[model samples]
Structures are given as structure tokens and as C-alpha cells.
Target: MEMTGKCRLLGIVAALATATPVVAADAADVYGAPPIESGWKYQVALDGWFTALDGSIGLRGLPAADVNVSALDAIEHLEGAFAASFQATGDSWLLYSDFMWSKISADADVGPFGGTVGFEQEQVLFTALVGYEVPVNIQNMQLYATGGLRYQHYSVDLSIDPVFFPGINRSGSQSWVDPIVGMALHYDINDRWFVDVMADVGGFGIASDITLQGTATVGYNWTDTISSSFGYRALYTDHSDGGFRYDATQHGLFTRLSFHF
Candidate 1:
């Protein structure tokens, strides 16, 4: 498969919490430390990921094409992108969910007729997980075992302009879901600083042959209910079906602003 061009939209989470300030309270602070209240805690977060794409894609029995697009290179063709996540935490159980959507356009020489090919693609990813805290002796730290489902949808449009034959246009979409299991670790450096790490693996040849993701971030509390973090994240997926194949890795800087209640 001689695939040519591919671009993944990097999300941007605006840290608007600083625009307005709130009094810091000690009773029930969020982010780094555990909640003091006995009731459930809720969190909403926005994220930005400026990633580089490296992978291969094939369609219609064609040879797989190489894809290498940088964040700067994708900016010109990026149409739209959005990403956000939600969380609910209890004494020893938690629920987390995330959603991301992106659209981009690219050009390549993969056309069967030896002409330029235009490719437009839109992708959506949603993930949800339930976790239970694992007991440990360490103080100011927590660990959780997590299980979840990941859903992916792709819509692609292709245009091929051949020298002799009429132009060809095609559009199609595919959707699939995968089962995943992982672990999360959160450690508080102090009253104002913290670190978080998470890793997951999925697929088991059920949907995509295999999928992997990892994230690590360091955050600072701005108030009892607001915080910001910056770190790195990497994700990889491999899947093939009905003459369509996508095996790619996206890795880059990750930023987030979170609100707790």
C-alpha cells in the first residue's frame, strides 16, 4: 500500500481559569489532594495536544502509504478540532470519560492513475472508564485499576485527477469499539503541586489488532476548584478491515485546565 498524506488535529484546551480568580479554600480543595468531603467529587477538563503523525494507511487493496505530518505542517489544512473530558470520584471508585473530534485535508501522489490525490478526513474518539482505588501504604498518593471502552469513527473523502480518464471521487466512513484496561497513579508533591500518570492497552485482536496509550502530567492548584497541567501523551492504534488499514502513532505536548466541584 502506497499511502501518502495523513494529518491528525491536535486539541487546544484554553486555560481560562486564570481570567477570573476565586478565593482559595482549605475545606474541600480539588486537583492534587483528595477531597475532604465524604460525598462524590466532580471534575471537568479541557485539553490540547500538539502531536506529530507517523503511520501507514491503505485503502481499496492499494499498497500502504507512509504518513508523517508535523503539528506545524498540519495547521494550514486543519479545519476544526475539539477535546474535553469529565470525571466523577468517590471514596474508592471513579468514572472518567473523554471525547475528541478533528478534521483535516491533505494531498498526495497515491492516485492509481498517476495523478495528484486530495484527501479529507474527519475523526472522532470517545473513551469511558471505571476505576477503583488500590490501597497502598504511601501517603499523599493514590493508585487505581481501570477498565473501559474506546470508540473510534473515521470519515474520509478522496479525489483523484487522472490525465486521460475522468476524475474519481469517493467517500466512506467506518466505526468500531475496543475494550481496554489500565492503571492510574496520582501523587501529591505538596499543597500546590502534583503528578499524574496513566497507561492502557487494548484491542486483543477484537477491533484494532492492538492499541496503546500513555500520559504523564504535572499540575499546580490555582484555587480550591481550579488547576492547570502540562505534560506528554502518546497513542498508537493498528486496525485493518475491508481493504482499509490504519496503523499510526500520535505523540506530543499535552496541556489541560481542570475545574472541580
Candidate 2:
């Protein structure tokens, strides 16, 4: 009997050891939800605001004379944007590819010229990001910073009214590859509700000068599937020609609605 009892105890120990891995795997799957391998997200936004532009225009080699003019002015503004992102996640790392298009239109009156200028800027960015969640007692709060490369295209048109300049139209398109950097703070009210604030800044090519853009937003997530946000954005650009300089500033309020899958 003693021999049989000892064998039974040994058999129980072996069974528990064999079942340990299976139990642990099941617990991990239940507690540590993994990110989807692939998914698509889309967003649309509406924006409105005021803008100010300050720059100097130089006219050289015109009728054997050089003319330099400085302008400081502001305008009423309106804008919109659309964005889509594809996501990839790992145990301790996450990657996202984002494509976004933003447009702004405003009118400014300077000197004897009363005209409207509009700009549309678009970007496709790919980033490999690594993030760590803070070890706070609160659940679902994360802070992350990302740096990557972005390809940007900017289109601008300045139209002078017939009252200002008989028939003068100025328009140009520029594209460049630039470095992008950003930071984000996200808080989850629950599994299906959250808020985020994000900011990004970058510079384009040599001729394009330097540019900075920032935005702040409050948002809500639905069913871990859809999101809607309202926010404000500001942009500044310092552009220079061979002998001329153009400084532009724009600010606006925006609303965004997005779907994630």
C-alpha cells in the first residue's frame, strides 16, 4: 500500500507539471490581448480660424529699379483634413503608417493688393515606433514619441481680385522629403472611450525653408472601432527667395470623425 500511494503522488505531480504550460497559455491569451496584424483607419475633419501673414517681396531688375515691400496682415480662415493609418503591433513595439491631407483657405488685404491665398498640404508618413506604458496605478494611460520620414507636397495659390490687380494670378507647387517628429498622450476612460493630444513638427528642403505645425485635440473612441475629435491647429512657414522673404502664420479650429477597423 505504501508503494502504491507513493506512485500515485508521483503521478499527480507529473500531471500538474504537464498541465502548467497549457494553463499559462490560456491565461495569457485571455489577459494579454494582442493587436490585430493588419487594419485600416479613416478620418475626416472640418476646420475654421484666423490667419496672419508677414513677408517681404522684392522686385529686382524691373525697369532698372529694385523695389522691396514688407507686409503684415491677418485673414479669416477655414480648412479641412482627411487621414488614414495602417497599424502593426508587437509584444512591446507598435508601428503605424499614416497618410493625411490638409487644406486651408484665407483672405488677406495688404497695401494696395486685396487678394485671397489658399494652401493645401499633404503627407504620407511611415514610422516604426516603440512605446512603453507608464506603470501608474491608473489603467490605459500611455505616453509615446515617434520620429520618422515623411514625404510632403504643398500647393499654394494667390489670387488678386480685379479691383486690386487688373489680372494677376500667383500659384506654385512644391514637394520634398522631410524628417518628422511627434509626441502623443492618450488616456482611456474605459475600454471604448479615450482622449488624446498630439503634436508634430518638421522641416522641408533647403529652398522651402523651415516649417512648424502643431495641433491639440480632445477625442472619444467608440467600441474600439470609431473615433471623433475636435481640435485646433497652427502653422508657421518662413520662406525665402534669392533676395526676398515670406513669413506666413495660420491658425484654425477643426473637427474630425474617424473609423477604425
Candidate 3:
């Protein structure tokens, strides 16, 4: 794929940028972290989410149809997929990015047509963010506020297939980029464990009517450059135009293994 090269380049840059103090196992006691060293820091994280999605989609001459299912169910019918994340940091600044893509085929019963329906769904999402760590008086805690851009693209191909009538195929796509702002809070309970909470809001008429995302995680510092985390994440968006509408919520347990450098 043409995007393969771009993905690789992004990964490399993230690896270079993500090496910072958040993942360090040993640091001074200000917050169980040392002041950011004067070079590039990077991290690569692999995450898995047992995702469930709920939404509605529509085509020309047809009313919007609801879509709700587990990502595992969609993957059972998937054609291809890819997902990953990268981060780079400085003493007080950070850069992060992530990408996800999936293609699935599913069955939908169309109420208006009074027949069984089939559809293919393809989705791609990418987010790039830059954050600055804020000085906090609270002990053993770090706060960061960030701003970024999120790109989302979704497409659906519908087939009204049955023995009774001629088959009809309809396809439509929607893509948008929205500016987002959010905050992250991290607190170290001890040397080996920490907690993180984050939330973001976006899509102020830029694409969707509104969009929101939130996450909470507990992390275990395993080594000087490795950490593990488990979290719950949720994302919601409402988007509509004349012919295409995509309103959905995706939430699930998310786990990650991260490497720092």
C-alpha cells in the first residue's frame, strides 16, 4: 500500500520523539520523574481494545440505518486491519500520534426495503497531538494540556441482495479533520504504579456536530524503559450531511505494552 511507507516513517519519528521521563522507573522524587533530559525521547506502544461500536449510516434514497456491534464480531468478518501508536517527548513538551484502520463485512436488515441487506465498512483514524506539561503544586502528580488534530474517514458499500429482486449496490464515504483540546493527569502512587485520566472534546461544527473521548488507566512500571497499562476508553461522535450520516460510540477495555528510549 502507498500508505505503508508513510506509516513506517511516522513510526520512526515517534520512536525518536517518545523517550521521556514518564516511563522511567528511577528518577528524582519531585514526581518520581527526572527533569526531561536535553535530547529526543521516544516510545512505541502496542494496544488492543475489545471494541464495541454503535452508530447509524445512510445512503441516497434510503433512511439512515443503525449499526452496533463488537469489534471482535466485525473482525470475524474483516478483510484487513492495522493499528499502532507512537510518542516523542522533551523536558516539558511531547508529541504523540496514533493510527487505526479496519475493513469489515456485515449483514444488515433494511426495514424500509423489507429485505435482508449486506454492507462493507471501512474506517481509518489518525490523531496527532502536541502537549505541554504544566507545573503543578500537587505532590507526585503531573498535568498536561494538549491540542491536536484528528482525522477520521469512513465508507460503506451497501448491497440489497435477494432472490426476489435485482441486486442494488450503493456506496458512500465521509471524511473529516477536527481540532481537539484535552488534558491528561498522571499521579504516581508509588515507585512501581501510577494512574492516568484523560479527556478530550472536539468537532465544533468542523465535521461532526460534536465529538468526545475519554480514558482512564492504571500503569505498572516494569523496568527503566518499559511499562504496561490497562484502561477503559470511549469515543463518541455525531456527524451528518445531506446524504451521509455517521453517529457512533465506541468503548472498550484497552491494554497497552509500551517501550521507552
Best-to-worst order by TM-score is: 1, 3, 2
Better of 1 and 2 by TM-score: 1
Give per-model TM-scores. 0.79, 0.57, 0.77
lDDT per residue, candidate 1, 1-261, as tens digits? 223222221111123344333424432354456545588989999988777678876666355667777777566778898999998888899799989898888876755557777777788989999999999999999899999999988887767677788777766677899999999888999999999898899999999999999999999999999999999998899988887788889888889899989
Regions of candidate 1 where Cα sits further than 4 Å from its true position: 1-37, 108-117, 158-170
Q: How many backbone clashes does candidate 3 have?
A: 10
Clash pairs (backbone) in predicted model 2: none
Model 2 / residue 133 / CA error / Å: 5.9
The Cα error of candidate 1 at residue 234, in Å, is 1.5
- Per-residue lDDT, model 2, residue 242, is 41
TM-score of 1: 0.79
- Per-residue error for 72 in candidate 3, Å, reads 3.9
CA error at residue 180 for candidate 2, angstroms: 2.5
Worst 10 residues of 2 by lDDT: 61-70
